[model samples]
Target: MKSMMMLMLLLFLMPVQAGTPISEYENLLITEVVVTPTDAEMIEIHNKGGVTLDLTDVYLTDATFSNGNVYYYQVVSGAGGGGDFNDFFARFPNGASIAPGAYQTISINGSDNFFSTYGVNPTYELFEDGAGADTVDDMVEATPGSIDDDPGGTVAGVSALSGGEVAVLFYWDGNSDLVQDIDYVVWGDKREAVDKTGISIDGPDADAITSVYLDDTVIASQAVINASSHAGGNSWQRGNLNEGNETGSNGNGVNGDDETSEDLNNTFFEGLPTPNAAAGAPPAPNLIINEVDAVSSGGEFVEIYGSANTSADNLSLVFYDGDTDQVYQVIDLTGSSTDSNGFLLVGNTGLSPDVTIADDSLQDGADAVALYNIDASAFIVGDPVTVNDIMDALVYDSGQADDAGLLTLINPGQSQIDEGSNGNAANESMARCPNASGGSLNTSTYQAVDPTPGVLNSLCPLGDYYATADDTNATTLRNTLHEIIDDHIVFPYSAGTTDTWDVLSFADEDPNDSNLVWMIYKNNSYTWKGGGQQAYNREHTWPQSYGFSSGSLGDDNAARTDAHHLMLSDVTYNGNRGNLYFDDCNAGCTELTTDVNNGVGGGSGTYPGNSNWFDGDSFEVWNFRKGDIARAMFYMDLRYAGDVSGEVDLQLTDNPGDIQTGQPFMGLLSVLIDWHNGDPVDSIEQIRNERVYSYQGNRNPFIDHPEWVECIFVQGGACTTVGDDLIFASDFD
Candidate 1:
């Protein structure tokens, strides 16, 4: 959210072209400063003008500090301590000029080490001050390439590094006289001035006071480096130069232009200090904990890829399990690395032997994995890791929230890491859609895909079904509904056994009732699917006899085998349901399935179903199970709604010829739709929806979105008014 606001501000302030006229003061913009220990006083300047400007008469002066003493030092080149500004900056002989789009430094000799770090040669190095200074007012200047003795004075040097208000001024004198100022940048709040609250640079004035600064726009946009909030590593500059982190049209400007003010946002740098170097220098990492295969049966693995060509060396990928609440594992990546785009960090090489791997730490369902800057070997269970240590953290799960219920992040320090959340499910990984150029990890940026460890994230299978909706009525969404499901793997059915037993445990795992299995179809209660004596079988909620192929044991028998619908029903009740359509089995006919008298009990006679509305040809479902039954039936009907030559071959209609060798159809459409709306999705149905999605690589669209029923089956208003045109919003609205 903060990044968004920054982007808006950047756009609002970005100049259309780099042709704006730059005042002399705007040309030499102050970007960085260090004033502490009395011995180390420095400032970095950026040249933002169109062409090089001579600095012959430029002066680095003070606007009276707490002592109220006016002092000035000439800005020149080379090492110096006396003459003009050997204590500040030296002048560049006679015809000297700063090149356009350049940087210059104004510092004392004590800060040479800091300037050396970024390889920025200073404009002038202050001459040695020997031991200490004892004065309230004094001034020093030197000629090019010379360090002269400090001229003793009663006045002292600039104030110490404590948080006080100070403004660095850069003004030019047209002639030899030091009065008529051409341009100046009055940075920091000058405490010695009359008004100490607001900025004096943009104040109302004429040629009096310190009013000859730059244009109103420059005054309004000068990025004032806040001394109070300044930290050791933090520098004031553009966070992302490519993304327009600078101001003004000139390439030299790092923080301010005529478009924005040196407000709090612009003042100081965004990261660690780089003294003489350009502000906002060094871009953030574009590396992402790209993908993870936590639920992969093939073994767990995590992949890290860089959208940009960043070295992968010295980085450590850390894993933290919420169950343990500590750093469970740490993979210390070695070598002069970093160009690790296709790097796969897998544990137990046997898991993905054919692929490239560096290291491990297994991740299962509902887990958290964090990538850190260095090794976390000392971190163990219960020990809280420094949030700063974690570069990027991701939670691989389908649950709406993390185990701890904390929202995940999608960037790093001030920052650039990612943590995926919501709409992300099992059997697939969370990957950035357009690779790495993203800022958030919500439903849009992260996509679920089949585990593609060690490969370009986008190379994985498309998410035919990772995302599911609940209250959708969009025709466009309904039209592409089938696209959300992928059929890479499917489980076939048996008389009593199938992947159902294993998958169902997770789908409806209940320990107390004979192992973690939701058995003996009823509503919300678990008994047993039975054993030796007599047992219930996998009941096709949408029975096979009514037009679905009874599993040939191979794929393609979705109606008979899809786990989303198959449930545990009494064996005797199973034989009784046969190929009956769902309706009010009231008239004189054989009844089956839905009540005790439906012939389901430990000891049962061949007493035909009396209460379970079954009229020989059609069956009636219990009220509690209506919505569940309706969803499964719709799932089977639409899942296999593959184009039949040109039209949908399978549909839920009243008449669907004799069992086999006949077109597929179911009946009591009005009743089913009523049942669907009346019951809504319950706790059990929702559990089943999640479980089926976890196992079958797809979910019952109706279960996820019960509203799809009317949108799909009504004719004109019921959503199935018998024509395609009537199925969409445009038809009626």
Candidate 2:
């Protein structure tokens, strides 16, 4: 027999087949790298991976130029974008991984200039000053196969060389003086010593500028010197190209007739004669026109940018009616194809001209740019959404079904529950909001998360126990519990033995596991703290739904004994348990079993709780087997039935789920039938029965010492006080 038992136990303990590990690469990719005219010697590294890549150790270098040692740089973990300072360069704000195949652009400007012009022969560079021109000259490969445009396609040089209009890159030299200076000349015309549109000599106070001409017609330009605009000695220029805007009737040898009256076809960045130290915090997302594909009655194809270098990612923009305060839609602009000025080139589907027109030329949508301000009271660290608001939004945006798109943005756990999945969020939340006191559901019974001992993820320790002194009411309750447990309840330790349940201490080895800890819930979070002291809130076993009136449960004749249906419970569990009757299986039946000895030998006969009265129709006594049923039924009796007149019908229950009401008790009782072969004991149950004894306190002698079998029903079967008298006095009868 022992061998068979051991074999069965071993078989039960054997491990089940393991399931496949979840792959992180299951999500869909969203943003891709967008290339356009405004690329401007810049490149974005999109997160095309399944998870956020830690870019801290990731290397970025320029290896295209003839010079092997061009430039090198590194991206710090959280320093890149979205107003966050410590992110993995490979990742973004909120730990969101750049979606698989998504682009994460790294600009070759400001602090990131090294990657722009690191390796190049005839080298690629940004020339702030040219002796022959007044404006900064951006060297380009006017002739194909030129030196300035040569990328050598090297790992250290430019990533690409322009076939018709090559480009040059620049960086702030870190000179606090704000003085602009000539950096370097990268000639790409295949000519080692070309004229290169060099800046001409400048007179005192005259700004020297370089101008490009095709058939004596200027098109693009950049500035080089700090000369007055009127006395332009040096002016900046785009590549050395001169395309006539349009040949006018008075056209001279010059395609357009007048040099100063030429059409501005090309683009240029005019360096202010004096740098404006106070540049309005570059417009939230300094967008620029990157490209313009097409423009017609149809929508336009434009791209916008949200870079990590800028503080723009923190913004939440909405499209609204220009005339009315009506809001349209919110957009995630961080990945929009845009230029440095926050304008999509035009014609991008995201920025279609038709959509723009429909929205009133972008001006209307501009009015919708209101901030989604955070409400301090509603805010939680991991999520920005409020419960009710999120629920409404989900209903509106996703229809009756769960919206995977919206869920993608919310915490996965919350999303699951919101979608009606039996995830832990709802359960956890309900379990954490119970009343602290073992009895009473009142304002004074409220408990909160403990603030001191400040363990972020762990529960409050016993020494720092807040409920003990949060208020006079809580203190009294604590005292009462101590007295009751010491006197009536027999703790394993109090019985001259070591307490088996010593897991309540924060010092427990598995402090992180809430299940292993006592006096706390499943999250390692405190069940109750002093009122308003921490994250916890007191829970009530007997809901105050019936009324808030309070009095002793046994005080049947008392006028104010209406609100006696309250007991402490975990906060989060309370929500999950919700409000319901305990009679889950059958009315008035509990799962509790009586000892065989008590049932047959008549030892200590009657069941606990005076609330259990003899009912000849069915059974002699009532007992709540399921803990939840007892709690819920108690709540209903004390709150609802006690306050208002109603049929006090018994409920049927089967242990369907964690109970918070009466009906479920009957179900639990059935479930425990197989295991019941001995005496049943529950301290709280004993107290309840004692209190309800004859609707009187301990002063009632008859209630204290009555016929043992008068009204008793043991686990084995039913018993009746009337039957017992007849059986005992059979001869007399």
What Cα-based lDDT does every candidate model obtain? 0.47, 0.24
| Best candidate (score: TM-score) | 1
Q: Per-residue error at 355 for model 1, in Å?
A: 23
> What clash count goes with each model?
52, 165
Error of 2 at 395 (Å): 70
Point out where model 1 deviates above 4 Å.
1-478, 486-488, 494-498, 508-516, 519-534, 546-556, 589-611, 644-648, 656-661, 718-733
312-372, model 2: which lDDT tens digit per residue?
2333333333233344444433332322112232232444321232322333111212222
Give the residue spans of candidate 2 off by over 4 A. 1-565, 579-679, 684-717, 722-733
Q: Candidate 1, which ten residues in sequence have the lowest lDDT sum? A: 73-82
Taking all chains together, the TM-score of candidate 2 against the true structure is 0.17
lDDT of 1 by residue, 1-733 (tens): 9999999999999987542233554556556566443434555566666677666544453333324222321121122122322223233324545677777665544334334544554565443333553221112343332234334532223342233333334333432212222222233332322111222221222333432212222222232333233444444443322222233542212122322222332224346555556765433344556666665444567666642224444567666665655656666664423231224444447555323343334556355667666544545555543455456666555452345521243332222112323343445666554343234232244566555555444332234343443224445445456555434235424211123444454455553353435433332334444322335556666656545553221222555556777776656766677666776545575534343322332212233322344555677666566778887777776666554322234577644353233456676677788778877897667756655654455667777556567777765443432224643645565
